[model samples]
Target chain A: MTAYTATVTVRLKRGVLDPEAETTQQALERLGFELSDLRSADRFEVDLDAADADEAADRADEMAERLLANPTIHDYEVAVAER
Target chain B: MTAYTATVTVRLKRGVLDPEAETTQQALERLGFELSDLRSADRFEVDLDAADADEAADRADEMAERLLANPTIHDYEVAVAER
Candidate 1:
């Protein structure tokens, strides 16, 4: 089996409130940096063994769907690479 | 000036503890998924006006350094793209 690293990025769906991003934007403004808006996401990198890249991606997708991401509020994408 | 979006990613420095990632990994294992290790990071996307991409990136870098990231335990990157 080949080893792979799967990267999953999870972001809040459009219209979802992102308080942390908002707070961060405000802090930037206070620091004299100008910005219109801000959004934040969570990125997960998982290392595992699999027969091929596709298998590794499938497993990582399952992980994101089941635990790493909250479906109702999150949108996630997965990318796999040999490790 | 033009509008730009800057992406900043914050990750725990090497040797720092990441309990949340550990918990997520355990939960995945409980669900019958195998993985060697898991790491997580936060990504921020900021939109702002600047004279050019360089200015936007600099402002975003400042944001990451001043508040978006904790230098002691976090490492961040800034990327800028026209919006």
Candidate 2:
């Protein structure tokens, strides 16, 4: 088995209300930083033993689908790299 | 000015207690997914008009330093892409 790190990024779907991002944008503006828009996401990195990159990605994808992301409101992407 | 998106990823510093990640790992184990370890992070995507990629990255880095991440406990990275 090879060690692989699966990176899963979960973000709210488009048109969803992102109060956190809004608050962040306001905070940046308050600090005199100019920005038109902002969005926020959660990223999870899982280190595990797998046969190959594809196997690692598959397991990570399942984890995202089952726990990391809310299917109705979140869109997630999974990437794997050898460790 | 050109449209750009700045992606800032914030993660806890090593040795910091990451309860969320620990809980997530436990949950995945309960779901029958095998993983040795897991780490969680926050990512922010800021869309704005900037003079260049470097300028966008600079602003995003400042945002991360001032608001998005806690310098005492978190580490962050900033990436910029044309939008």
Candidate 3:
């Protein structure tokens, strides 16, 4: 089995009222940051002991779908770190 | 100014009771994931109009310190995407 690290990001849908995100955006703008697009997401770093990269990804995806995110209001993506 | 993309990740310090992070970790373990360290953080994707990489990074760090994170409870790191 190979050890892999997965970084998962979960974000609310565009229309969702993410107060935290909104506040951050406003704060950034106030700090003289000129941004074209600003999006906020939640990140998770999971160290996985899996059979391989594929298995790690599969398990991470499953975890995101089942528990890490609220499917109706949030979306998620997983990035596996290269060894 | 150059256009740059920055990804900032903010997380609560260790031992902070992150309900979301805890739940995610538990779910992963249940799904047969063996992990050494699992941390939860918040991610932001910002498209910045800056003079260059250094400027963008400087602005990003300022944003993170002043607004994107609560210094007492949360810490943040910024990653600049290469164009």
Candidate 4:
């Protein structure tokens, strides 16, 4: 088995209300930073033993689908790299 | 000005306690997934008009320093791309 680090990025689907991002944008503007838009995402990195990169990615994808992301509102992507 | 998207990824400093990541790892294990370690991060994507990629990255870096991350315990990276 090879050690791989899988990165799962979960993002809110378009058209969803992102209150946290909105609040962050306002805070940045208050600090004199100009930004037209902002979005926030959650990233999870899992280090595991797998036969190959594809196997690691598949595990991470399942993790995202089952727990990391809510299918109703979030979209996610998974990528894997050698440790 | 050109439109750019700045992606700021904030991660916990090494040795920092990450309860969320630990919990996530345990949850995955319970679901019959095997993982050695896990970590979590926050990614903020900021869209704005800027003179160039450098300017956009600078703004995003400031955002991460001031609000997106806690310098005392977090590390962050900013990447800018054309929209």
Q: Please give, for residues A1-83, the per-residue lDDT of candidate 2 as tens digits.
A: 99999999999999999998898899899999999999999999999999999999999999999999999999999999999
* Ten contiguous residues minimizing lDDT sum, candidate 4 chain B: B57-66
In the range B1-83, model 4's lDDT, one tens digit per residue, is: 99999999999999999999898889989999989999999999999999999988888888888899999999999999999
- Per-candidate clashes come to 0, 0, 0, 0
Model 2 regions lying over 4 Å from their true place = none
lDDT of 3 by residue, B1-83 (tens): 77888888888987788887667677777876667667888788888888778888887888888788899899789998755
lDDT of 1: 0.91
| Candidate 4: tens digits of C-alpha lDDT, residues A1-83 | 99999999999999999999999999889999888999999999999999999888988999999999999999999989999
DockQ-based ranking: 2, 4, 1, 3
Model 1's TM-score against the true structure = 0.94
Q: What share of the true interface contacts does candidate 1 keep?
A: 0.98
lDDT of 2 by residue, B1-83 (tens): 99999999999999999999999999999999999999999999999899999998988998898899999999999999999
DockQ-superior candidate, 1 or 2: 2
| Candidate 1 local Cα displacement, residue A68, angstroms | 1.0
Candidate achieving the largest DockQ: 2
lDDT of 1 by residue, A1-83 (tens): 99999999999999999898788778778887777888999999999999999999999998888988899999999999999
Worst lDDT run of 10 residues, candidate 2 chain B, spans B57-66
User: Which clashing pairs does model 2 show?
Assistant: none
The models' CA-based lDDT, in order, is 0.91, 0.94, 0.81, 0.93
- By TM-score, the candidates rank as 2, 4, 1, 3
Classified by CAPRI criteria, candidate 2 counts as: high
Choose 2 or 3, whichever is better by DockQ: 2
Query: How much of the real interface does each model capture, measured as fnat?
Result: 0.98, 0.98, 0.89, 0.98
